[model samples]
Target chain A: MKKLINGVDQIVSEMVEGLVAAHPDKLRAIENTNVIVRADAPVQGKVALISGGGSGHEPAHAGYVGEGLLDAAVSGEVFTSPTPDQVLEAIKAVDSGAGVLLIVKNYSGDVMNFDMAADLAEAEDITVKQVVIRDDVAISNPDDRRGVAGTTLVHMIAGAAAAEGKSLDEVEAIAQGVADNVRSMGVSLAPCTVPASGKPGFTLEENEMEIGTGIHGEQGVERRELMQADAVTEELVQHVLDDMHLNDGSEVALMINGQGATPLMELYIVARKAIQLLKDRGIHVKKTFVGEYMTSLEMTGCSVTILNLDEERKRLLLSGRE
Target chain B: MKKLINGVDQIVSEMVEGLVAAHPDKLRAIENTNVIVRADAPVQGKVALISGGGSGHEPAHAGYVGEGLLDAAVSGEVFTSPTPDQVLEAIKAVDSGAGVLLIVKNYSGDVMNFDMAADLAEAEDITVKQVVIRDDVAISNPDDRRGVAGTTLVHMIAGAAAAEGKSLDEVEAIAQGVADNVRSMGVSLAPCTVPASGKPGFTLEENEMEIGTGIHGEQGVERRELMQADAVTEELVQHVLDDMHLNDGSEVALMINGQGATPLMELYIVARKAIQLLKDRGIHVKKTFVGEYMTSLEMTGCSVTILNLDEERKRLLLSGRE
Candidate 1:
C-alpha cells in the first residue's frame, strides 16, 4: 500500500502532534497521551463534552474539538478503541465544576471503553453522563447498528448546547435526542489499508461496490455491480427515509459525508441527488453539510445522513462557530 | 476507474447545483451558467473579487465564494479551463460600481481566459484588475512555474482585502504581493482520472512517486522510489524554502494541501514534519492550514505551500469568515 506515513506504531502520536502544531491557537495535545483538548479548555462552569474512538477518522473527534464543539477527544490506534486510561485523561483535563458528558459512537469497543472511562471519572467525584449514537440504519437489528457520519450531527448540536452552559443532564439529553433521530447509510467502492497490516481490509472488483459498508471496512449488506451516482445515492437516502418514518412536511438536516478517497466534486454530485430525492418526497432540508466529517482511511465511498430536526435542534445546530 | 458521479457531461453542472443548493444561505448560481456568486452579490461599494479555472479543484474557487472571499467563481469542465464567456458572466454578475479583481492561476489557459474576461468587463464600463499567481517552485524556470495550492492563500488574502472596501487597485496590489511571495511543491504517488476520459492521467508503480507534480496531473520534475512521510515532506519544504529565500527570523504561513486521496491522518503527519523543519531553521509559522484546500481529483499525494507574510497580510488572512 502506498500510504504517507512513517512507522505504523507512530501514526497516532505523530498525527496528534501534527494536528496540534497546525492549530495551536485552537487545539492542544496532552503530554504523553493521545488526548487532544481545546486550547482554552476546562471552562469553570460550563458542561464539558468529550468524544473519541479510533485514529483513522481524522477531523472527527479531534477536528471537532473547539469552542462550539467537543472540549476534548481521546484517539486510539487505527480502527481500535482508546484505552480507558486515555479517555479518563481527557475527562479529567476538560471537566470543570459543571461536569462532563461522553458522546460515543455505537461500536461495542467504543461504547465499552468510554463507559469504563465514565465509571473511572465518577469515582473521582466528577459527575459524568454518556450518550451512545446508533445512527447507521444499515443493520436490520437496531441494537446492532453502528454510528457513522450522523455522529457528527450529534457533536454539533450537543456541543453547541454544552457551550451554551447547559447542565450535564441537559447536554446528555440533547445528545441522546440527536442519536435517536438521526440516520445514516454508506456505500464503498474500495477498501482502505490499515498502516500496520499493510493490506486492504477488503477488496472489490474494478466494477463492483459494497452497499451498507461500515466505516472500519466491515462486511456490507450486499455486493453488487457499481451503479450510477444518482442510483447509489437514491438507495442510501431511501433506506434512511424508510427508517426515519418521515412524512410530507418534515424538516431535516442533510449531510453527504465522503470516505477518505472520494473527491469533494463527487461528494457534491451525490449531494445534488440526495437533496433532489428528499425534496421529491416533500421533505424540507433545513441545513446541509457536504464534506468529509467522518472517514475511513483512504476508503473511496460516501455516506448519506439525515437528522430529523426539531425547532430546538435546528437552533442549536445553526448556532456553532463556523 | 470508479467515481461517484453521473454522466461525465453532467458532472460540473450537477456539482455546481449541489454546491449552491447545500449553501443557499451563502452562495447562488447565475441562472443557466456555471457561475457561482455570493448570495448577497453586487454589494454596491465593496470591490468584488472573482476567481475560477478547471472544476476538479473542488472548493478552490466556489467553496471560497462567500463573504470575505470571492464574489464569484466560474467552473469549467474537469481538467479544462473555463471559457471566457462564462468568466464574463461571473464578472458581470458580481461587479459593483467599485469594480472587480480577477485572481487567475498562472496556467496559460486560465491566464488567457481570465484576461479576456477582464477586457469584456472593462468594455461594459466596469473597472477590472487582474493578478496572476505563479507560486509553484517546481519548475526551475520561474516563468514556467505553475500555480498550485498557494492560490487558496491568494483567495483568502485578496478576498479579505476586497471585502474591506478596498479599491480595485488596492486589492490588486495585495493579491499581486501574495502571488509574488508564495512558493509551493508537490509529489504524487498515483494519478487521478479525469471523469470525461475515464482513464488515469498517468501511471506509477506501487513503489514509485512523481516529485513536483502539478495539480493537473502534469509530468513532474523527477520520478523516484516512494519515501517516508517525513523524508517526502522535507524534500517538498526544502525546495519551497530554498526558492523563497526565507531567513532565520522570517515568519510565514504554511499549508499542507492534500491532493485528493491522502487521508487527513497522513496530511497531518506531513504537516508535523513541515512545521518542524521550518522551526529548525528558526522560522515561525504564523498560521497553518492542513486539509484538502486545493486538490487534483483523487490523486494520492500532497503539496506544501509557504507564503512569506507581513503584518498587513497576516491581518487580512486572519480576518475572514471561517
Candidate 2:
C-alpha cells in the first residue's frame, strides 16, 4: 500500500502532532496522549463536547474540534477504539462548571469504552452524560444500527448547545434529539487499506459497488453492479427518508459526505440528485453541506445523511460557530 | 475507470450542473455554456477575475467563486482546455465597466484559447488583461514551466484586490507579481484516468512514483522507486527553494495540496515535515493551507507550493475573502 506515513505504528500520534501543529490557534494535543482539545478548552461557563473513535476516519472527531463544534476528541489507532483512560483524560482536560457531554458513535468497541470513561469522569464529580448515536438506516434493526457520518451532525448540535452555555442535561437531551432524528446510508466503490495491514479489507470487481457500507470498511447491505450516479444516490436517500419517516412537507438538513477518495465534483453530483429527490417528494432542504467532513482512509464512496430539523436543531445547525 | 459520472461525454456539463445546484447561493452557470459565474457577478466598477482550464481540477476554478475569488470560471472536458467561445461568454457575463482579468495556466491549449477569448472580448469594447502563471519549478526551463497549484494563490490575491475595487491595471499587476513569486513541485504514486479515455494517462508499478508529474497525469522528471514521504517531500521542496533563491529570514506562505485521492492524514504528515524543513532553513512560514486545493482527478500524490511573500502580497493573502 502506498501511504505517506513514517511508520505504521506511529500513524495515530504523528497525525495528532501534525494536526496540532497546523491548527495551533484552534487546537492542541494532550501532553502525552492521543487526545485533541480546542485551544481554549475548559471554558469556565460552557459545557464540553467530546467525541472520537478510530484514527482512519479523519476530520471526523478531530477536524470538527473548534469553537462551535467539538471541544475535545479522543482518538485510538486506525479502526480501533480508544481506551477508557484516554477518554477520561480528555474529559478532565475539557470539563468546566457547566459539565461535559460524550457523543459516542454506536460501534461496539467505542460505546463500551466511552461508557466506562463517562463513569470514571462521573466518579470525580464531573457530571458526564453520554448520547449514543445509532443513525445508520442501512441496518434494519434499530438496536444493531452503526453510527456513521450522521455522528458529525450530533457533534454540531451538541457543540452548539454547549457553546451557548447550556447545562449538562439540556446539552445531552438536545444531542439525543438529533441522534433520534438523523439517518445515514453509504455506498463504497473501493475498499480502504489500513496502514498496518497494507491490504484492502475487501475488494469489489470493476463494475460492482457496496451499497450501505459502514465507514470502517464494513460490509454493506448489498453488493450489486454499478449503477448510475443518480440511481445510487436515490437508493441511499430513499433508505434514509423512509427510516426517518420524512415525508411530504418534512423540513430537514442534508449532508452529502465523501468517504475520503471521492472527488468534490462527484459529491456535488450526488447532492444534485439528492436535493431533487427530496424536492420531488416535497421535503424542504433547509440547510445543505457537501464535502469530506468525515472520511474512511482513502475509500472511494459517499454517505447521504438526513436530519429531521426542528427550530432548535435548525438554529444550532446554522449557528456558524466554526 | 471507477468514476461516478453519468457518461464519458457528459462529465463536464453534468459536473457544472451539479456545482451550480449545490452552491446556488454563491455561484450560477451561464445558460447552455460550460461557464460558471458568481451568483452576484457584474459588480459594477470592480474588476472581474476569471480562471479556467480542464474540469478535473475542481474547486480550483469553480469552488473559488465567492465573495473574494473568481467572478467566473470556464470549463472544458476532463483534462482538456475550454473552447475560445466558452471563455468569451464568461468574459462577457462577468465584465463590468471596470474591465476583467483572466488568470491562465501555462498549458499551451489554455493559453491559446484564453488569448483568443480576450481578443474577442476586446472587439466588444471590453477591456481585458491576462496573467499567465508558470510557477512549476520541476521544469528546468523557466519559459516552458507549467502552472500548477500555485495558480490558486494568484486567484486569491487577484480576487481580493478586485473585490476591494482596485483598478484593472492594479489587479492585473498584483496577480502578475504573485504569479512570478510563486513556485511549486508535485509527486504522484499513480496516474489519473480521464473518463473519455477510460484509462490512466500512464502506469506505475507497486513500488514506483513520479517525482514531478503534471496535473494532467503527464510523466514527471523522474520515475523511480518509492521513497519515504519526508525524503520525497525534501526533493520537491529543495527544488523550489533553489529555483526561487529564497534565503534565511525569507517569509513565505506554504501550501501542501493533496492531489484528489490522498488522505488528509497524509497531507498533514507532509505539512509537518515541510514546515519543519523551512524552519531549519531559517525561512519563516507565515500562513499555511493543507488540503485538496487542486487535484489530478484520483491520483494518489501531493504538491507543495511556496510563495515568497512581501507586505502587499501578505496583506492580500490574509484578506480571507473566501
Candidate 3:
C-alpha cells in the first residue's frame, strides 16, 4: 500500500511530532515517554484522567486529552497496549495533588499494563482509581472481558466529572455508572494491515464478514452468512439490547461506530437501521452518535453501542456536559 | 461483505438508535430526524452551535455536540451534505433565544446547502453566523478553496468557545479565527469500498498511496511513488508546513488522522516521524491528536492537519471545554 513516511521504525515518533507540532496550544509530549498530555494538565484539584490503548485510533485517547476530556494519553504500539512504564509516565505527567483516574478498556493487556501502572502510582501515593469498561456485547469473551467500542463513553463520563473538579471517588463512580449503562456490539468486514508488516492482519473471503470482532480485527462471535446492512444491524443490536436488557420505553444513548473501512454512506445506512430497530422495539433514544469514535484500521463493517439512561446516570452524563 | 444488518435503508437510523441507547444520559435525538443535539443544548441564552457533514466521521459533528462542542448536528446522506430543511430543523430545535453559529466544513456542497439553510433560518430572525472551514491544505477544486481536514479544528475551537456561553459575535470570531489558523493535507493508500456497492470507491495499486485526497475518497493532489512511512511523513509535513508558511518557532496542533484502513501501528509510526520533523524544525507543538478524526472511509493511508494556534485561540480551545 502507499504510505507517507520516512521509515517504519520512526513513523510513530514522527506522527507524534506532527501531533505536537499541530496543536501547540493544548498538547505536549511527556518527557522520554510515548505519551501526550494537555499543556495545562494537572489542574491542581481536578482529578487527572488518563486513558490509552493502541496507537492507530488517534484523536482518541490523545486527541481527547484536552480541556474537558482526558488529561493524558499513553500510547502503545499499534493495536497494542502501552508498556507499563509508558502508562506510569502518563500517570506521572498528569498526576495532580488531588489524584489520578485510570480509565481502561476491557482488553487483557490494557488492563494488566494500566493496572500495574496504577499500582506503581499508588505506591507513589497517587491514589489511582481504576474503571475497566467491558461493554461490548457482541462477542462473549469466555470468562474475560474484551474492550471494544463503548470505552469512549467511560472516558467522557469520567473525564467530564474529573474536569469539573470531582474527586477520584466521584469520577470512578461516574465512570462505573457509565459502564453500567452502556453496551456495545461490533461487525468486521475487510481486514486491516499492521503498520510494520504492511500486510493484512486477517484473511477473509469476498462475501464474508466476522461478527463480534474487536479493534484488532480478531475473530468476533461468529462468521455468519453475509447479509445486508440492515440484517447485520438487527443481529448486532439484538445482542447489545439483550445483553444490556434494554426494553421498549427505555431511553438510551446510541453509538454506531465504523470499524475503519466502512464509508459514511454505508455507516449511515447502518445507523438508520439501528435507529429504526430501536424504534420498532419501542426503545426511546435520548441521544445518538454515528461515526468513528473507536475503530480498527481499515476493517470494513460497523458496531453499535447503546447506553441506557437512568436519572442519576443521565444527570452525570449530562451534568457539566454543557 | 458480512455485516450485522437487516436491510440497507435502515442502517443510519438504527446506528443512531444504538448510539443514543448507549448514552441516554449524555445525549438526545430529535424526533424523526437524523439530527442530534446535546442533552444540555441551548443553555438559556447561549448561542446554539450547529455543525455537521456526512454521517461517517462520528464525534466530528455529533460526538462534539455534547456540552461545549456543538448544540446540534445535521447529517446528510453519507458523504453528502445535510439538506437545508434538515439544517433548518436543527437550527430551530436548538435556537435558545440567542443566535446560532453554524460551523460548516469547506466542502462546496456543504457550504452552499448550509448557507441556503442559514438564509432560511435568518428569515426566522434567529441570529445566525457561519464560518466556512476551508482549512484543508490539500488543493481540492483547484480554483476553489478546498475544505479538507482542518475543518475539524474549526469545529473544535468554535465549539469550545460557544460552550463557554460565548455570544454569537464571540463564537463567530473564534470560529473565524480558527478557520484562519488551520490548514490540512491528506493522503490515502488503498480505497475502502462503499457499503451499498460492496466495491472499493477508488483503487490504488497494492503498493501505492493517494496523497492530498479528500475525506470521502475523493482525488487528492499527488500520487507519488510509494515510500516508507517515514518518507511519507516527511513529504506530507513538508508540504503542510510549507503551505502554512509556519515559521520555525510557530506553535501548532498536529493531527495524524488515519483514513479508514491503515492499522494503528502505521499511524503511530507516522506520528513519531511527524513529531520529530516538527521538533527538528523548531516548531513548538502545543497539542497533538493522532487518530481517525476526519476519515476517508476505509482508505488505507492517513492525513495530516495543522492548526496554527495563538494565545487567544488556545484559551478558547481550552476553556470550558467538555
Question: Whose TM-score is higher: candidate 1's or candidate 2's?
Answer: 1
Residue-level lDDT of model 2, residues A5-62, one tens digit each, is: 7888878888888788777888899999999999999888898999999888888889
**Residues B1-322, candidate 2, lDDT per residue (tens digit)?**
8877677787778778877776787789999998999998888888999999988887778888878889999989888899999999999999987999999999999999999999999999999999999988889999999999999999998999998889999999999999999999999997888888888889999999999899888778999898888888888899888889788999899999999999998888888888889989999888888898888888899999999999899999887563
Question: How many clashes does the backbone of model 1 have?
Answer: 0
lDDT minimum window of 10 residues, candidate 3 chain A: A313-322
RMSD of candidates 1 onward, in order: 0.9, 1.4, 5.8
Q: What CAPRI class is candidate 2?
A: medium
lDDT of 2 at B297: 85
Query: Which residue segments of model 2 deviate by more than 4 Å?
Result: none
- TM agreement with the true structure for every prediction: 0.99, 0.98, 0.72
Report the error of model 3 at residue A227, Å.
2.0
* lDDT of model 1, residue A46: 90
lDDT of 3 by residue, A1-322 (tens): 3455565565556656656655677789986677999888767888888999877665466767787788888878777788999999888888878888888888888999999998888899888888888887655662365667777877766777777777788888888888777888888777776678888888778777788887787778898667877788888889887777676688887878877656544666677677888889898776666666787756677888999888755665665332
Select the stronger candidate by lDDT from 1 and 3: 1
- What is the alpha-carbon interface RMSD for each candidate? 0.7, 1.2, 4.8
Predicted structure 3, TM vs. truth: 0.72
- By lDDT, rank the candidates, best first: 1, 2, 3
* Fnat by candidate, in order: 0.83, 0.52, 0.52
